[model samples]
Target: MHPRAGQTKKRTRIQAKNEAKILEAALDIFATFGFRGTTIDQIAQKAEMSKPNLLYYFRRKEDIYISVLERTLDEWLTPLTELDPDGDPIEEIGKYTSLKLKMSQNDPTASRLFANEILHGAPMIEHVLKGSLKNLVDEKAAVIHHWVKAGKLTKVDPYHLIFMIWATTQHYADFKIQMRAILGDDVDQPDYYEKAGQTISTVFFEGIKPR
Candidate 1:
């Protein structure tokens, strides 16, 4: 089960602190090595705790990985899930694009970890992808469809639009090496994410604006 919010039950401050440390370390390790490549020993070491102590909080590697993934997905989906059906469609899309780009800049590793899972066929997160993620996407897709039908947006495939946004926004984080190689020093500049957001928003909204 996911250890999100209330699901984890009550814990003392010390327990919470240790759990947070473990998850943070696990995220770094798992993001770098992925599921198969990562070992419990590595996570324990990164967390600066004994293996048995770490095991006291999380029993298995899979458990830790799933918990990390669940938290990551929940964080990643916040902006998407917040897309308001009542707001201006174009502006909403722009906001979502901006938020996603910011996330790429702020938390690249989580994006890479999620990408790594998908690249490996998403064996670990297949259920959430098919169930909760799909459901949320479908819900938003329908909203987009309504906007198009109402002449708020140009006719476009709602699902593919969302996919394009995901692909374009995440490229900065997932392919930072290639981006850095190509853009050189510019990629490290403070305005990189803002510029990326503008570029992606242009690509997505330019054609889709009601003509």
Candidate 2:
């Protein structure tokens, strides 16, 4: 028999400072260097722990990276899942804008880590992309289809819409040095996310909202 979803999926907890510190260090380390390039020793040093102690929680560098991704992906896709199929399209879009911007601003490390994974062709996470990520995309595409059919939003390729969202939101994180040099250091200021959110939201909602 197939295992139940709840049974198969376990959650993470940051019950203590050390665990949180470890994860924070792991996130920064993985983001700075791609998975193949990061080392357990580096992570341990960053977290102020010995390699053996870090290994107590995460067996390998891959495990730590996956943990960070799991936590980040869960938070990242939340805005989509929060969209109320029955609610106003404009409102949902606004909420998504803020949520996505917050991820870009507050969790740039997580974003870079994910970007690094995909840039290298996602050898470790292709399975996840094919499975859970693909499933969620298909499900949301169905909702977006209804909006288009009902004349609530513009008719656009749903897959490409998703891709646009990911690409636009992740650009600052993935291309930090270039973006900073071009836009100035304040590109990451708090207002930066607000401005980005508002700009993207306006551009999208204006184009899509039943005109």
Q: Rate the local accuracy (lDDT) of all candidates.
A: 0.90, 0.78
> Cα RMSD to native, each candidate?
3.8, 5.6
TM-score of each candidate? 0.90, 0.83
Q: What TM-score would you give candidate 2 relative to the actual structure?
A: 0.83
Error of 2 at 2 (Å): 30
Q: In model 1, how large is the Cα lDDT of residue 199?
A: 68
Candidate 1 per-residue C-alpha lDDT over 24-93 given as tens digits, one digit per residue, 9 for 90 to 100: 9999999989999999999999999999889888878898999899989889888899999999999999
- lDDT, residue 7, model 1: 56
Off by more than 4 A, model 2: 1-17, 207-211
Evaluate model 2: give its lDDT. Answer: 0.78
Per-residue lDDT of model 2, residues 52-149, tens digit only: 88877666777788878887788776777877788887677567756776777777887888888888999888998899888888988788778878
What residue pairs are clashing in model 1? none
